[model samples]
Target: MTGFHYKGGLRIATLLCFFFILDQPAYADGVRPGYQVVSRAEIIEAMRQCDDYDPTATTNGARFQGEMILYLAQKARARDPQGLPLFIGYENWFQAFMEVTARAEDAMPQYAQLSYQYKQNTEIDYRIDRVIREIVEAPTPELAVNVRIWWEYQPGKPDRYSYMDTLSTPNLKVTNQRVMTYRLLDFGNWVAYDEIKGLTGRPTSGILGFLFRIIGEGHILQTRMAISKDGLQFNRATAKKGFIKRIDTVTVYPDGKMEKDIPPDRPDLLEIAKRITQPLEIDYAELSGEK
Candidate 1:
């Protein structure tokens, strides 16, 4: 829930450049033809402001605190298919955390009410929120990447995940993709929720569109993604600019193989592999030589 703003003064030069060339095809929407590859130092410097980016602090203060409490409550309540508690390895610590929450509630009355509601609704619709961050540096040092992924359950609304990166040049922050998803059943499967109108790839045609449908039926790997440098967009468009977002999908097989809709040569997708997919421990043989 972090408010979308970089820490430095707006680069008037970049803004002027954007205004002078806003109508360019690269600046507008749709698949970008290509991207400029920058040195490791440049990538790092572009994303310097993002080192302090905090996703948890963007929303109202109470919501995140409430979200934490609810998340813990759901974890404590999770059950396996056999109707057993899912806290196999960390049961004791999880219970201790619950007890601490109880103590907190004793210290604060409102905490008790929130905790009770969250725990009670474990059987009903609930949300499980998680965030993961990683940095990947290739051996050639061609890319120094910082990736932040947001994959979370949003009960009552269309569940979705987002990928953001700090590799966009000059401004290292941009959201490459955000896709909607939904629970298939209680058996732990989710499909892309794209049947609704107004989504990026509508009419559900073409390879990418078909890929979205296939991914809908597959076991969602639940991973998150990129930033654009030139003509890049911000989460908060102060100067009428936003992140250069693309709606793309991928399929993860049972054996851990991945097939993405993006053509292999796209630089954004290459960065996605290095910055996000590699960290998940899925082997990308093409990037096998990368560190």
Candidate 2:
């Protein structure tokens, strides 16, 4: 009843690991003479530009903003290897910029407005904006990233809910280590109430309903990543207490290919692994705002 769920779980774990890895700093020297060292003030300015991004501009202004935000993030990572302020800042800025780009590209003014309103009313913690505030008020030497997600379904009761938590510190050994853990609270239910709700539009009752929940509740999944001079290694596990109950490993090549055993049926996991491992490629002309 208690074990790792590899089918859909690996995909989620891999994605989270990939995001965390993107935040990690590369081993390199200080910033170049042309690029300025990232600062909280600079991040704020960049965010403001992203917030005011105009879809109607003659030029691809939104994309330019995104590129600038990414450039700043890279410089920040290079300048401050010990502190994650710049890295976190860049992540938040990039996310907001992407939202603007997507909305503008799709010509969805209504959705864009709604999205902006939602962000305005939401708490900083719920959004990446909180990271910006924390980095500005009090920067930490090390970053500790931990995320958790869950869902439950009980007939004749409220069926679905989810939450997330993030913390940064100076003591954690794995500065760049990223871990994503998912714990299902219901027993023997593969499909959470939310999933069933999406499909059937209502929670089903009785023995038939229980039969579909074969995934089980209280099942936990944890994925960890380690970066070395050679490449990256991702370790996945199902955990109970603080110890790993079961474990699996997947290695990613520099070319973004999987070097580990993966089931033939799960081509999705293989694709994700490749995407995460592939080296980053950016065009200088685009980033430089050149026509």
Candidate 3:
């Protein structure tokens, strides 16, 4: 399958779009208490300070935990008009990947053996760390990274993936294929994967083949994912870009019943939000001899 590559210009456009939408009242209200718009300078300073800041020096590390809570809240609030946060995209992507792979492994235990090989053999250009590190290291007017992923799965063979970055590739006679592309934005990454499906897999010699020749290939299921840079924290997933535009507290039942704008299942984020809104438990003024 073909790999996807986007130039640096898209990042600029994405950032403009991300911040422009923040002017809306809905976006303003999206930020809960204790969350502030953190600048790059502040992010850098916090990273530096917290790297060495000893939470153990204080009572039960409450102050350090408080600082982290504040940092997380600040990052979480850094969402686009679509409500995709900046700090947890990686986590989201990983979760989705694991879920799919888990099902595959459960059905075919043989898939588990090639898991490591797929990562090891994939093209270097689109490797997860390589893509993220390249973006983090040289973020500017001209970007050099081409973010994309390609994988082909055959029932008994090791998965084939990410050999080239192109629009389309030659189809295998019996392989199932997936093509994934990444739009690395200043705010976060937009990940879209298309699972090749439908009559496209039919032979091109008979009446079905003649119809296929006229209509080309089959339909693709495109799943759009938005994630933070490190791919470890925030995410908007499982649907097209515009479907879930905002995050609301709701629950869905197995029977298709829906609850709109209800309380969330977990209170961890709420507690963190409350903690970040308060003063640090430790007094920094009294500390001496450490920078």
TM-score of each: 0.20, 0.25, 0.21
Candidate 3 residue-wise lDDT, 204-280, digit = tens: 45464465556543432222222112211111112112232222222222221223322365454353223212221
User: What is the per-residue lDDT of model 1 for residues 29-104, given as tens digits with 9 covering 90 to 100?
Assistant: 2122222212223222322323322211211111222222223223333432122211111112223333433444
lDDT of 3: 0.25
lDDT of 1: 0.22
Please provide, for model 2 over 96-193, each residue's C-alpha lDDT reduced to its tens digit, 9 standing for 90 to 100.
54454554424533222322222211000111231222332211212221122111222453333121101101000111111122211111111111
Better of 2 and 3 by lDDT: 2
Selected candidate, larger TM-score, 2 vs 3: 2
Candidate 1 minimal-lDDT segment of 10 residues: 10-19
List runs of model 3 lying over 4 Å from the truth: 1-114, 119-145, 150-179, 188-232, 238-291
lDDT of each: 0.22, 0.26, 0.25
